[model samples]
Structures are given as C-alpha cells and as structure tokens.
Target: MDDLAVAIGLVLVIEGLLWALAPRMGRRLLEAASETPESSLRLAGTLAVAAGVLIVWIARG
Candidate 1:
C-alpha cells in the first residue's frame, strides 16, 4: 500500500541521515550491536515494534 511505501521511505531517510551525519557513531553502534547478547537484542527489537505500533495507532486514530 502507499502508506507502507512512505513508511519504508521515512525509515530509510532517517537511517541515511544518521549514517551521513555520524558515520563514526553509526559504526560504533553497529559494533556494540554486534557484541550485544541475542536475547537483549530481541527484547529491544520487540519493544521498538510495540512502540512503533503504538505510535501508528495513535496517529491513525
């Protein structure tokens, strides 16, 4: 759907900005993520998904 495309584009733009403006920090974050435990990463990802869903639900309401 059109909304999905726009959402994906927005995500890409934000990610691009981070890498462009703070390449060193981005690399550091990537390194930290790589060293993180899988369970912790999973929990963080789940939380992010829940937060994103809540944001979208509120925005659409």
Candidate 2:
C-alpha cells in the first residue's frame, strides 16, 4: 500500500541521516547492539512494534 511504502521510505531517510551525519556513532551503536542479548533485542523490537501500532491507530482515528 502507499502508506506502507511511505512509512518504509521515512524509516530509510531517518536511518540514512543518522549514518551520514554520525557514522562513527552509528557504528558504535551497532556494535553495542550486536553484543546485546537476543532476549533483550526481541523485547525491544516487540515494544517498538506495539508502540508503532498504537501511534498509527491513534493517528488514523
């Protein structure tokens, strides 16, 4: 859908800006993320998805 495409595009733009403006910090953050536990990552990802859904639902309403 068009909305999904736009959401993906926005995510890319934001991520690209962070990498372009602060590649060093981005790399370090990734490195730290890599060392993080799978459980923690899963929990974080789940929370992010829930939050995103809530945001979209409210916005649409």
Which candidate leads the pack in lDDT?
1
lDDT of 1 by residue, 1-61 (tens): 9999999999999999999999999999999999999999999999999999999999999
lDDT of 2 by residue, 1-61 (tens): 9999999999999999998999999999999999999999999999999999999999998
Clashes of 2: 0
TM-score of candidate 2 to 2 decimals: 0.94
Instruction: Give the lowest summed-lDDT range of ten residues in model 1.
Output: 18-27
Task: Pick the TM-score winner.
Answer: 1
Q: Model 2: clashing residue pairs?
A: none
| Cα displacement (Å) at residue 27, model 2 | 0.5
Where model 1 places Cα greater than 4 Å from the true spot, the runs are none
Task: Provide C-alpha RMSD values for all models, in order.
Answer: 0.5, 0.7
